[model samples]
Target: MPEVKRKYVTPGELVGKGRYNRTSNVYQIEDKFYSTRVGMAEVINDSLRVIPLTGPYIPREDDLVVGKIIDHSAFAWEVDINSCFSSFLLAQSVFGRDYSPARDSLTKKFAIGDLVTAKILAFDRTRDPLLSVSGPGLGRINQGEIVSISPTKVPRVIGKKGAMIKTIENYSKCRLTVGQNGLVMISGNPEGIILAKSALDLINHEAHTADLTQKVQDLLSGSNNGEKE
Candidate 1:
């Protein structure tokens, strides 16, 4: 595997050129790639992409996100997805063919303040994004504490091939469900949940550091040792 070179860049800063191709949050002029936003530039295997350091969550199809129910209409419930745009969870999306908003109360099924894990079915800048909770691992989050972090740091928390998250779960002895929109739900032993939250905080604080993985491991190890003593 190639070592990825990561660096922070400002708007219009040169990201890469030549063999490096641009991805999200960047632009190209001829052969030169430049960042269009304030973000971290990542170069991996001939591909270069900039991850925005600060911005609202841009909804993409099939993204599993954690959302809080804020309001409801006769046919759909409004969800705050930790983004500038709110999402809509329709009654039909939840109940399929049996759904009848007139016959059934939408609030009865999902009340305000309920945290839900749902998928983005469709998203359009002009209209509110559509969401669904019909898939596996997608539903009401009844147990667990929700932790919020910067959306850009989500990938780092997950790590490559889920190694970082696995490490956190093992060390904390907690079951974690991470949403792309920066909401994480931790469930298990109360102590483990606290440890998990602490681990996530460390990851968020040092996301730009190259040795972040090792630092996280060290942090967890120290926490575990304290518990033993």
Candidate 2:
């Protein structure tokens, strides 16, 4: 396995000089790659990218997002995924191909203000994102406390190989589903949920700091008086 290198970088900083199979959030200057934003730069074997530390959520294909149903047209429901654009979940995605507006009422399935965990099916500069909730763990979010953080800090919340999230879950005894949009849905006892949220807040605030994983572990291990649910 090729070794990976990661470091915080500012815009215009030199990232590396080498041929890479994939590179993003960076511009190539001949064989050299330069950072395009203030964020974490990662060089993984043949791949390279900068994960921005602060930015609006940009819709990407296959992104798991937690969104709220804000409005609905005859054919699709508009979802606010905490991005510059509102995404649309088509009726055909939820209902069958032969769906009828008269027979299939959109509100019957998901009403306005309903929170949904969905995937981005398609997106481009020309149109708003298209979404789908027709898979395992996708659909209306029935219950759970939602906690939001900066979208860029999502990777930190998840931790290396999911170690941070697993640590929070193990210590707080909460089930957390994190959306790339920086939304997290936590379900467990009220006390556990409170504890998990605190951990998430810590991660969001100190994502750029060193030894973050250890800090999160320490926070989770400490006493947490349950907040009022």
Candidate 3:
């Protein structure tokens, strides 16, 4: 087994050589590999990859995301998924045959400024993302304030097996829906909402630090005590 090197890398920097397969945001020339983006490099076993610290969210199929309605056409509505590229939710995808432009207005169904939780149906670099609200846990979000964070920090917020997020919910007494695109919807008491937002901010600020789970736990515990006193 080869030792995995974990470190920050810059563009054009050598990642690894020979027998290591390169993946995501890196380029290869023969057996030698180089990074094409600025990120942290992770080498595990025979696989090597880069995790970008900053970049636009590249949509992937089946990704659950939170978005705001930005614009609408006769048959579809455009959504801002906190990415450089916008997504489209077709009328038929949401309303099926009940969507009738002649008798019903698209705006009335999904007006601008409405927040939604949707699933990506398809995505390619050349085309806008296709979204759907037909699955479980997918639909219009009527309440709660949305908080934005760096998309790269989503995994940290989620933590191992959802430990970190569950901690936030318990401490703040807020029910949260976290989107992979870095949008979090908080629903509960005003004080709990504020505490949840603060915890999320802490995660975003210290995602790269070690013992992050412990740090988030300590923060939540301290806040919970303050609320009781």
Q: TM-score for every candidate vs. truth?
A: 0.90, 0.88, 0.90
Q: Give the TM-score of candidate 2.
A: 0.88
Best by lDDT: 2
Clashes of each: 0, 0, 0
Q: Which stretches of candidate 2 lie over 4 Å from their true place?
A: 1-7, 44-46, 223-229
Q: Model 3, 201: alpha-carbon shift in Å?
A: 0.9
Candidate 1 vs candidate 2, lDDT winner: 2
lDDT of 1 at 162: 97
What lDDT would each prediction earn against the true structure?
0.88, 0.92, 0.86
Which clashing pairs does model 1 show? none
Residue 148, model 2, lDDT:
92
Q: Residue by residue across 69-188, what tens digits does model 1's lDDT show?
A: 999988899999998898999998876778886788887888999999999999987888999999788989989999999888899999999999999999999988889999999999
The candidate 3 region of ten consecutive residues with least summed lDDT is 220-229
- Candidate 2, 89-112: lDDT as tens digits: 999889989988988999999999
Ranked by lDDT from best down, the candidates are: 2, 1, 3
* Prediction 1 TM-score vs. true: 0.90
